[model samples]
Target: MSTDLQWLLLRKYNSYMVKGLPEGPIFSKEPGNLVNIHSHKYSGLSNSKTIDVSDENGVIQITTRKTASPHTIASTRSTSNIRARSGGRRALRVASAPAKQGYRPDLRRATLARVSALLAAQKEPKAQPAKKPRGKKTKASA
Candidate 1:
């Protein structure tokens, strides 16, 4: 008999690379106004359109705020769609590099489980007050 799966249907990319090979002449054939990502881009300083140039630089820096590249603006928002847990909380576990592609029912389930656990953990415990003295009244009450 075929089994059923209680799973979240999410669209995800087989691979997600935050920073690609850098955006300029591969090696600066001639260093002059080459477009390159700023050093701080990795530190979350990337505003919609923030730019920084080095004192010893020769490059053009266009950020997401501007149209550095059409692909940058049209990029997928986040990895949230990959709810199937192709890799849930990478830092939580250690493993080899992930595959390029191919459906992975196993990872999908794990991801689903991780998310479910997180949601479950967020639930507040039923308000539990301390039990009061029973079977005897305090002298102060009397």
Candidate 2:
């Protein structure tokens, strides 16, 4: 009888590294764990992209893609590291720093000048029209 089961695939590299020595990369397969799978998915490295797990004849097989080179993976990881280090909010703050540096003082000065002009205008006395003097009543002769 043929049975199908889900397995978790992992790409592992040799922990030991020597200068000027060729590195050996290894692939590992483990029993499928939902929690691990979810975590991997959340990390943006899912089955098709980074991990490769397959089952043949009720046995788990761990394999690596020939197209993905070590250099390419290293470059991709470096870029991700850079992004994680900078962070989203920190990058925004850095980008807006220059604009903010010169903006506030100028804005404050302009606001103060406008307010002072308005206050001066308000303090000036308004001109009024002169009123005509009323004539005294005169007695008329019949």
Model number with the top lDDT? 2
Off by over 4 Å in 2: 1-7, 10-38, 43-68, 80-89, 92-142
Please give the lDDT score at residue 69 for candidate 2.
Answer: 56
Compose the digit string of candidate 2's lDDT tens values, residues 10-122.
22222221223245432222322212222333112333223222334333222222225556764432111112233434433432332255522222332233223333443
All predictions: root-mean-square deviation over Cα?
20.6, 29.8
Estimated TM-score for each candidate = 0.27, 0.17
Q: Model 2, 5: alpha-carbon shift in Å?
A: 11
What tens digits encode model 1's per-residue C-alpha lDDT throughout 1-142?
A: 1111111111111111133466642221111111321222211122222222112122111111232454666562222122223343541222111211222222333333433444344445899897766555555556
Query: What pairs collide in candidate 1?
Result: 34-59, 48-65, 49-65, 85-111
Clash list (residue pairs), candidate 2: none
Error of 2 at 135 (Å): 84
